[model samples]
Target chain A: MAGGGDELKLLGTFASPFVMRAKLALSFKGLSFEDVEEDLANKSQLLLESNPAEKKVPVLIHNGKPVCDSRVIVQYIDEAFSGNGAPLLPADPYERAVARFWAAYVDDKVLCHVLEAARGKTEEEKAEGLKQTLVAVETMEAAFKTCSKGKPFFGGDRVGYLDVTLGGLVVWVHAGAALYGMRLFDDAKSPFLAAWVERFGALDAAKAVLPAVERVVEFAKMRQAQAAAPATAGGN
Target chain B: MAGGGDELKLLGTFASPFVMRAKLALSFKGLSFEDVEEDLANKSQLLLESNPAEKKVPVLIHNGKPVCDSRVIVQYIDEAFSGNGAPLLPADPYERAVARFWAAYVDDKVLCHVLEAARGKTEEEKAEGLKQTLVAVETMEAAFKTCSKGKPFFGGDRVGYLDVTLGGLVVWVHAGAALYGMRLFDDAKSPFLAAWVERFGALDAAKAVLPAVERVVEFAKMRQAQAAAPATAGGN
Candidate 1:
């Protein structure tokens, strides 16, 4: 299990950045896995039973053991298969610590902030959410400048775990913002991040795991409309 | 590094529940460590340089390498020394997933809501915060009833990783609430949790690692005072 070549399965939803994190890791590791796409609205029994407490994706089943939490799944993949594919993390402990720090930071700071922003219902709420999202994006831009250090990807020349973890969110953010008619990423405001998003979009694995942007956008719009619709209408 | 008898160093502060989680793990493993207390307000150069990105504490520098994020640190400690201490996680992968899931659920749901409650600035804010806190606590109580079934600790007899994580926070929540005049844990409302709190409080490792209840209470009072102080006082 510490090496390569084992049965792997990924339980995830198409539009979830969390699920995509695991998918990108498995791909980046050059490890083949059985991808089980879950309906987030009506989650599969396997998904629910596998992760009953959280009842969320992506849950990575490796060699018959399920690892919940996207970051944890990435670490497990890196440790269990150290010899194959790109090393998800650096071999040096300090470097690994830095990577984990950023990974957790993205989850805690960036994702959480962005979700709050996206959840705003009114104009003022949306404005406040946008401000927070900008702050989060700016922080990530600074981190990437230090992390990438002018390299093409987060892992220097090649994409690695940190890149995947942070990069996977780009598609969802952009798609959701478009659906909500929100201007989240402006090239003039966040030049570095805008460019990073473009680079991430160009990745083969990213394209493979990413849902059709239009579909996600439509789904989000539909949900938002339904939520905003009057109760008497028997909203779809 | 993969076995027991490794030199373990913990960089932490006095107040952080996250830091306490790591400290409890080391103590539970019966592993002796050089505890490097960091000034989080004015973090030492080593702490700053060690985890530059986050600059937070409870970094377990095992065999001279730092591991940030309490959950990651616990898992690393558990894996690095598999057989020595009480097994931090279950042997079965699905059960392991369940353990990690709850550990995360507590962090994301309980801790997030509780921290917000603790940080409320106004009376109205405090009331809202308390409402949310009670909801999270009730949900946790129900979850714990299922999790703690036939088990002394969350690990079903022995104190496991999730237990240590939850135990560390329970100490802080109770102590902090008492000092702040916040009634977080009512005996009637959360009897099982209240009893579990006493049981966890009595653990030798918990007793050793936990600061005096008075110290934490004092810290909480000071925190509340500072938070309520005028903007000219330069407190954020």
Candidate 2:
């Protein structure tokens, strides 16, 4: 659909929330694209050729040209299919700048903290990780209140950039806490974030691309197990 | 200039290349703005309120609304003052995506490696750091050929997003190496990169924002001295 019925392909993995960003954007635009699953452990030729620098998945190819990164792909979809789909970014420059800032912040802080928290191997380390996680979540809680203004979503009744950017956080908040037996987004402390997650999770686009909650739980459980495994092993 | 003379302000410090990005964009657009130098050691109220999440400088204040992050601020300037200056990004959507991706890659890769190499405390660590630095530099060396196509700059003879983003690397390649007496960009090793630095350094905006080579050398010497100083000292 992005190529106007010409070849439009997406190379990504099944469980990557980043990949889901492109899918959600394409689906929201009602555009058809071929989806190719990637084995990240052994990247395919397409992945290598499409995004040589990172060689990571979620590369959107329109005709013969490749676009890398989920946010960039989403922006491309919004721009190429402008007037067809509801817009992802705000038309106003200032508002768009704010959205861009938040998207980058989620990448720079939220996702990293979630992964760091998940990587913790001991109670003390996990606690420190959780503290940082809450700090990031609290920042978002304030940001949501400032930007959303009591709307159902950041785009005001429509799923948009911030919602999709934070969509990955949905699984992480649930899965990360379960792995550590700790709560991250408590309703009392972060009421706005709690409500926003529910609103974002209910989106049709998100539902279509995200793996089941059980799958994420299993992923987190495996992570907890991996952390429990001893670090130093000797075969010789 | 961004808001039609509606009180544009930039909160930043002198030494920060990230802050210089905002200055470069504003000057490129020929915009008039109030420049507030922040004492980063004791961040001011305006800096704190403008960028609460990061508490970092380079917050562009158009009227009362604040935009954080140097690259995002540059994008904001381009969008807000599209008709005023030479366009900073390509008109094509796909090209825009590629520019954004590379801008991000420069942030994620080049800057970090440069910092790591500068932070090296031992000979072996410095060599390892320099190797990784060159590896990232090599990735960009390849990226330049793919994107520039024999153009003087990434934006085809104009100072553009990729140019400004990587121009920060110029100061680093000089200062970072001098701090540790190592070379990250050699003409024989990275011919395009060395030439690219020359072209970028010639830009008026680059000259305005970037510290002079002598100043950077002094800064590097100061960094070396700081690193040489003992970490723990008794305070009366």
Best by DockQ: 2
Q: Write the per-residue lDDT of candidate 2 for residues B1-236, one digit (tens) a residue.
A: 44465778999876677876678778777777898989876889989988999999899988898899999999999998888868888888878988889888887887776666657677778677667777888998888887888887776768788887777667756764666565567788888888888777777767766676668678567656766778663211
Q: Score the docking of each candidate (DockQ).
A: 0.27, 0.86
lDDT by residue for model 2 over A41-91, one digit each (tens)?
688998999898888989999989899988888888888788676888888
Model 1 lDDT per residue over A54-100, tens place = 78888988777667898878767776676776787876545655676
- Model 1: residue A133 alpha-carbon error in angstroms: 3.4
Model 1 clashing-pair count? 0
Q: What local lDDT does model 1 show for residue A149? A: 80
Q: Give the TM-score comparing model 1 with the true structure, all chains together.
A: 0.75
C-alpha positional error of residue A104 in candidate 1 after TM-score superposition, expressed in Å:
1.6
Model 2 TM-score, all chains together: 0.91
Ten consecutive residues with minimal summed lDDT in candidate 1 chain B? B176-185
Determine which window of 10 residues in candidate 2 chain B has minimal summed lDDT. B227-236
Off by over 4 Å in 2: A1-4, A121-125, A177-180, A222-236, B1-4, B120-128, B227-236
Q: Considering every candidate listed, which one attains the maximal lDDT? A: 2
